[model samples]
Structure formats: C-alpha cells, structure tokens
Target: MESNQTNRALIKATVIALSVAVVTLVLFILPAEYDIDPTGVGKKLGLTVFNQDGESPSAKTSTDGDQDTVVVTVPAGKGIEYKLSMMESQQVTYEWQTSNGELYVDLHGEPDGDNTGYFKSYTVATVESMKGSFVVPFNGSHGWYWKNNTDKDIDVQLIFSGEYIVEGLK
Candidate 1:
C-alpha cells in the first residue's frame, strides 16, 4: 500500500539522519574538542592533537619549584609556536635569546573555551633577546610565536620558572 511505503521511507530517513550525527560526533567533535577517540578515526585524521576546549591532553598543573629550559630550532623563513597552560592568577618568569640573529616574536594568550578568536597579545616585535615575568589573567594557554626571517636556521634558548604546564616542543 502507498501508506505503508510512506511510513517505511520516514523511518529510513530518521535512521539515516541519526547515523550521520553519530558518525560526525565520533569522527570529529569528540577528538578535536575533548581528545576522545573511541573509534580511532580522529587519530588517523590527526585531529586528536588539538583541543578546542582549551584543555590539552599534554597540559598539567604543577606547584613544585618547576623550572625548564628548551632549545628550539626554526628553519629559515619558517615559524613555530609553543604554549604553557596556566590557571587564572598564576605567574611565570621567562627569558629567551636567539643564538644567531633577530627574529620576529609574538607573546600572547588564549582563554579556555574561547571560540570567538579572542586572544591577548603582550608583545610583538623583532628581538634577539627578552626577559620578563607574566601574570596569567584567565584560565588559558599562554606562549610565544617565533618566526625565523633570515636565510639560515636559528637556535633559540628559552628558559622559564613557573607553576604552569608546558608541552614538549617539536
């Protein structure tokens, strides 16, 4: 009967819609937003490394006398970014210097769960060395973007003492 065919079509459409929704959640949203990858599809797609929720899986809070030093290498005409996780009101003292030449840098922070492209820039310029202290304004991630402008690779030595979480630089 025509009535029976209509009912079957409606049911089929509903099932298809639900299936697409679940696939989208599992393949994209879960991994990008929460680092959850039950089906491993997100990992295969390289989506699990990003956290749109403002919390990185590599992020950790530490209170002990923590100090770290890192050497970052940037190829010529290339750039890199690194960040430290901090709660509101946390502070850190930082210093960095380039072994070769002056480079462009931007020091900034992005608040947790911010989806409106909101960010705060503390410093932006070309500098060979810098030393300063930062006081976190919100629960978020703060760090630097460095660009190598010269025709040769550059080595940057960065040191920080703080009670925050930092990810390993690549």
Candidate 2:
C-alpha cells in the first residue's frame, strides 16, 4: 500500500513538472524566439518581432520621391530613434550633422511585420556627421538610433531625399 502511494505521488510530480515546462515554452520561448504566438500574449508583451526564417514580412508598395529636413534635440545622456518606412529597392540620399557633439549612431532596418525583435545593422559608429545614399534591401523601417553621451544637449539636423514615409522620432 505504501509503495503504491509513493508511485502515485512520483507520477503526479513528474506530470506537473512537464506541464509547467510546456506552458513556459509555448507562452514565452516560442514567441520570443520564433515569433510563434499561439496565445497572443507574447505579442502583447512586445516579444515577437521576427518570423521563423528571421526575416520581416513582404515589402510594401513604393511611394513617390520626396525630400524633407528635420531637426531634433537629443537630451544629455539620452538616445532617440528616427525611421523611414521604405519599400524594397527604394533609394535615399541622406545627410545628418550634430550641432555641437559627437553621437553614437546605429543605422539599421527592421522588417515590416516582424514580431520577433530582429534588426539588421548597416552602420555603427560615433560621429558628428554622416552623408550617404542607401538602397533599401527589404521592405521595412530603416533609420538611425543616435545616443548622446555627453553632458549637454545635442541638436541634429537631418536632410534626406527619398521614396519613403518619415516615421520621425520613436
């Protein structure tokens, strides 16, 4: 009788442990790693950002050519992201300069429908100014993340001509 009771308890514990592990894998690991959100909780928590193949969704339709200039201030010891929504193969020429100090800059892109927090970095550097032309390789939001590490605020002037929709600061 005692052996039977012990066996039952051991089985119950094993089953419970397996159940918890499965729940964790489905609710957290799958969604965070593969963008598979069967229960939708991972997406709500902002964990899904990429697809199974680690690519963003299809490219959006291209827009007409446009030009814009924007000025923004980065607070001391702060960072900001500025983006442009562009279709695959869209081209843009851009120039950005800082008012007074150098900034840590990351130029990158993320796919349109990626829920699995994946991004491709095109450039990363600490600099005061940059001028370049880019042809987007995929349909996605492409732009820069600038971090001001100094004690004073830094103003950035960005001028660009492209076929894109400005996503501004984010």
List CA RMSD, all candidates: 6.5, 8.9
User: If scored against the real structure, what TM-score would every candidate get?
Assistant: 0.63, 0.62
TM match of model 2 to true structure = 0.62
How many residue pairs clash in all the candidates, one count each? 0, 8
Off by over 4 Å in 1: 1-63
lDDT string for model 2 (43-133, tens) is: 8875563232344432322253455777878879988787888989888789999999999999999999999999999889999999998
lDDT of 2 at 35: 76
* Residue-level error in angstroms, candidate 2, position 155: 0.3
How well does candidate 1 match the true structure in TM-score terms? 0.63
* Model 1 lDDT on a 0 to 1 scale: 0.81
Clashing pairs in 2: 48-115, 48-116, 49-114, 49-115, 49-116, 49-117, 50-115, 50-116
Best of the candidates, TM-score: 1
lDDT tens readout by residue for model 1, 1-170: 99999999999999999999999998999886677899989989967645433433343334665667777776699887768888898888889999989999998889999999999998999999999988888988788889998999898899887767774331
